[model samples]
Target: MVAQDFIVDLNKPLVFQVGHLGEAYQEWVHQPIVSKEGPRFFESDFWEFLTRTVWWAVPLIWLPVVCWCISMSIRMGHSLPQISLMVVSGIFIWTLLEYTLHRFLFHIETKSYWGNTIHYLLHGCHHKHPMDGLRLVFPPTATAVLCLPFWNLVQLMSTPSITPALFGGGLLGYVIYDVTHYYLHHGQPSSEVPRNLKKYHLNHHFRIQNQGFGITSSLWDKVFGTLPQSKAAKKSR
Candidate 1:
């Protein structure tokens, strides 16, 4: 398909067709097609509205949960040292989880109809419309639904006294990840850390979608051997 064939209507709701995965995926991963209008996944206005979320809403939705978790952990009589260690561990775990999910799950390839549709709905839409600010962050409703199994897993592994602290730290790490992701996409960074991160993330989106899965930190990418090729190396290739 030619560039002119992929026109998007700003006034109407963005509706992706069931096919066109090949051409659409190529354009999206390389030169992203940004849209001013939001996409509609459901016929119901309320359900469709639930899928869109603002960047600030991430912290607003999760911060209280994090605070409550920590408070509950303290009230449960867990020692400061234990709670501190567990919380830090949880944050560290989140980094790995982030990398794994991005690389393995979000980027999963499928050719079947329903599988491809699910994949597009989950992550492909973001790549296709990177500038759709409302859809950049994960919706709170989806996050809450996904957190059920994670919370259950935490409960199974740790005592109630320590679980809250651990879960709190993980939740905080997620907030950081989401906020940092939004900043990477939309904010201009003056500092070295964010500047480097912005470049790294943009490279992932435009140059090497398979590599550089780490968003909050590239340490995992470095360790997992998924770091994007250097500019010099790309030029040589």
Candidate 2:
């Protein structure tokens, strides 16, 4: 199927239109379109609304949870220094998690109807509509659900005393990631770091989809050897 000059028919359900692409869906979905108008998912207004989220919504919904987790750690007798370390550790773990999830799960390839549909809703939509500001961050509901497994994994890895702070740290890391991601798409960075990040992320959307999965920083990408061979990287080296 021809990708250029293709436009999504916003009138009909987007799911069906995407499905109609069949094997061509993967190719079509990655062709970036700049639009703030989000595509419709469900017929119901409620479900469709849930798919779009603003950048600030991440901190608004999750900051309290992060604070609560940190408070719980304090109550459980963890020292301030220990808690600080754990919180930072959680954020560190989150950075790795960010890279891992983006590379493995979000970028997963599948050909089945449901697989494509689920993938589209999860991450493919962002690729197709990279500048849709509303879809830049993960919705709170979905993040809440995904938190369960990660929480359990943290518990399994460490004891309960440190879990609160550690988990809170990771959640904060996710928050930082979401905010950074939204900023990469919409914010103008006055400094060099964010400016570089914006260009790096845009390359992922517009140039190479399989490489450069790191968002908050490109540390993981370099370590994993998934770094984009963009001229910027070459020149920097």
C-alpha root-mean-square deviation, each candidate: 3.3, 2.8
TM-score of 2: 0.93
Q: Which pairs, if any, clash in model 2?
A: none
lDDT of 1: 0.80
lDDT of each: 0.80, 0.88
With candidate 2 superimposed using the best TM-score fit, by how many Å does residue 69's alpha carbon deviate from the native? 0.4
- Measured by lDDT, the strongest candidate is 2
Candidate 1 residue runs with Cα over 4 Å from true position: 1-16, 19-31, 35-37, 40-43, 235-237
Query: Which parts of model 2 are misplaced by more than 4 Å?
Result: 1-8, 232-237
Model 2, span 112-186: residue lDDT tens: 667778889989999988888888999999999999999999999889888989999999999999999999998
